[model samples]
Target: MQVIINGEVHDLEGQILLSELLERLDLKPGRIAIERNLEIVPKANWASTTISDGDRIEIVHFVGGG
Candidate 1:
């Protein structure tokens, strides 16, 4: 599947759920926010939200600084 994440194009194989995608990216679900195709997907729904071809995703991760 070809999807655009954070403005970059990615060729990911097979059907991937939102939660699975995060795992593949080595991202902790609790530390990030995801917007898929202009919709804000709730963390609890990540497991069910599926990523399809041409989907646009925006990811924002929280960071702490001293």
Candidate 2:
């Protein structure tokens, strides 16, 4: 399956949950927000949200600045 992430196309072996995708990307759940197909997905729903082919995902990271 293929999904568009932050404007880039990524190919995956099969369907996976949003949380799993984050883990595969080495992202810390606490430090990021997810937008799926133009909708904001709450952190509480990540584990239950199943990502499918053609899904568009946007991961926004929180950065600490001085």
Question: What's the lDDT for all of these models?
Answer: 0.92, 0.92
**For residue 33, what is the lDDT in candidate 2?**
85
- Rate residue 47 of model 2 by lDDT: 95
Off by over 4 Å in 2: 63-66
Q: What is candidate 1's local distance difference test score?
A: 0.92
Local accuracy of candidate 1 as per-residue lDDT tens digits, 1-66: 899999999999999999999899888767678999999999999999889999999999767878
Q: lDDT of model 1 at residue 15?
A: 91
Q: What shift in Å separates residue 48 of candidate 2 from its native position after superposition?
A: 0.3
Error of 1 at 14 (Å): 1.0
**lDDT, model 2, position 19:** 91
C-alpha lDDT of residue 54 in model 2 = 96
Best by TM-score: 2
Query: Distance from true position, residue 36, model 2, in Å?
Result: 0.4
Predict model 2's lDDT versus the native. 0.92
> RMSD of model 1, in Å?
2.0
- The local lDDT score (0 to 100) that residue 66 gets in candidate 1 is 88
Give the Å error, residue 22, model 2.
0.4
